[model samples]
Target: MPRILITGGCGFIGSSLASELLCLGYQVTVIDNLSRRGSELNLSRLLAMGAEFHKSDTCDPEALDKLNDSFSCLIECSAEPSVLSGAVGDGARSLLNVNLMGAVNSFEWARRRSVPVIFFSSSRVYPYDRLNACHYRETETRFEFVDGCSGVTQAGVSVSMPLDGVRSLYGASKLSAELILREYALQYGLPAIINRCGVVAGPWQMAREDQGVFTFWAARHYFRLPLQYIGFGGNGHQVRDLLHIQDLVDLVVRQVAALRDRPSDFRGDIYNAGGSIRSSLSLREATEICRRLTGHEVSTASRIEARPSDVIWYVTDNGPTGKVFGWEPKRSAEVVLQDIVAWIKDNASLLKEILV
Candidate 1:
């Protein structure tokens, strides 16, 4: 089996991928700064499971240079990841240093070592203004996107969605990284794959106000915490496609194999990935599911003032990726929610330390 290196591997997605790859008999090493909430716990899990760990921040290029080692592949999972991050003055530079510059170092390292790179971008790169402009019909339960919108596709928001407008600081950073990755692929012949993923939730997401919507929703309900619907007239009509981490890991395994055996055929281009239409859900719909799973209804407040960068509806069109990889997400919205419920119950004591 090929050895794998995952930067930011102690986070939810990276840790999950590392565990999966390790179980499949691959040697794995992870690097993390452990700066975020729940990272320490994630690190512990990875360490106990036999994944090697190194403490380093990607913001420092010198530190990254030290880890420019021989590995079959490098999965770039380090990013602020919050669409709401860097919206204010305090977070702007920090977000750029981590998301943009960190990515630069990752690309440079892969170029030097001739390692395959898998970059995790985000659907947040699509502008919120355009997403909101999509024509929609509102049922009593949720807001549904209609077909009048130019960029919108039947499967959901297509990869062809408008990019001429502002997509927030976080989006700009990720998109900037994607553009740079293209350069590395073309110039250095780096085996690169960019996955512009949507909301990925499952067992170990350190859900917060800025990211991890579904996991946070489930945790709030499980802990009897107060919840709020803050946008689109507070009807809880905002919808997004939800991808499970397991499905993403499944794809990564394939990408790694392609990069190792057939690097020339793997284009360093963008691939949009999410649960697609089959696994999308509205906030109201998610609330009902949580209620059923937790058997407890928590108080939820509704605010009409929408937050900056909040979109009404944004699901992914997996058509392009399906044509290439013949892969579609098998996890439904119900299974995604149910898994969170099970995780929360199983780790209620530890979660309360960080969540409550």
Candidate 2:
């Protein structure tokens, strides 16, 4: 059995991945800080399924030291992506410390053990500097990328795009960590895979302003909470290709399994993991879906300014990932939405526990 360690195993993607691993009969070990509100519930769910749990932060050097040689694979999903870039140098330091430095620490520990490491990166690593420079077409209810080959296919953004001048602090930190992972694979021959995941939504997400917009909206609608649209045009038509957590786990497991069969160097390499054009949806569409599914009134207040470094239309192409890993997302947008709504409805009583 593969002894796997998930660095942020208590969080959204990490917890979902751990649950899948347990179902597949893998011996899973999780290390997490348990700082996030709902992470404890995620951890408890995994523990109920018989996974080994450790309460520790992956950013700590001593904690990394203790994790040495104890697992066959390491999944690094622990990082802060929500801290606003405008919060002075202190916020910048926190992003670097958790997102970049934490990756270095985890990679070093995995390198020492010669174990494969998978890094959960973000789509923000792209060139946000080019966002407002491009024009988008408002077809029907959603926006589409309107330049070059990306327009015709609606296949969404590919990995070949440039990353220069992406001034967003979150993007920069994630890109820096990606570079560190690549260098470790190149310089030290450490095995690593970088997965730039699209908008990840599932039951585990606690719906904060900085992450999990879909779940956030659903929660807000269910509870009649306030929502402010702070990005793009006053019309909440900014598009994103949201992916379900289950699809993400399938990709991670397949990539890790492939590496075990033919361990090769993947230095500085990256892949975009997402649902592609078919799964792309705008906030307008999301709100309507929420209203229809939950039978609740959805309200939106518009703001003049968008979030810093917010991409106008960030979806995945998935061509390279499909070609390389023989994987494609299996669920549709309606399927994901229906499932999430059903999950929320069925577990209404447990929402407090899930939200922690």
TM-score of each: 0.98, 0.94
Model 2 lDDT-worst window of ten: 148-157
What total of clashing residue pairs does each candidate reach?
0, 1
Q: Candidate 2, residue 332: CA error in Å?
A: 1.6
Against the correct fold, how does model 2 do in TM-score? 0.94
lDDT by residue (1-356, candidate 1, tens digit) is 77899999999999999999999999998989987799899999888889989899887878878864769999999888888789976999999999999999988888898888999999988988878877888998888888766668767877787788778999999999999999899888888999989889999888887689899999999998889998899989989989988888887887888788888776577888899999999999999999999998988899999988889988988758867766778999989999999999999999987655
After superposition, the stretches of candidate 2 with alpha carbons farther than 4 Å from their true spots are 83-89, 148-153, 352-356
Name the best candidate (by lDDT): 1
Best by TM-score: 1
Question: Alpha-carbon error at 172 in model 2, in Å?
Answer: 0.9
lDDT of 1: 0.88
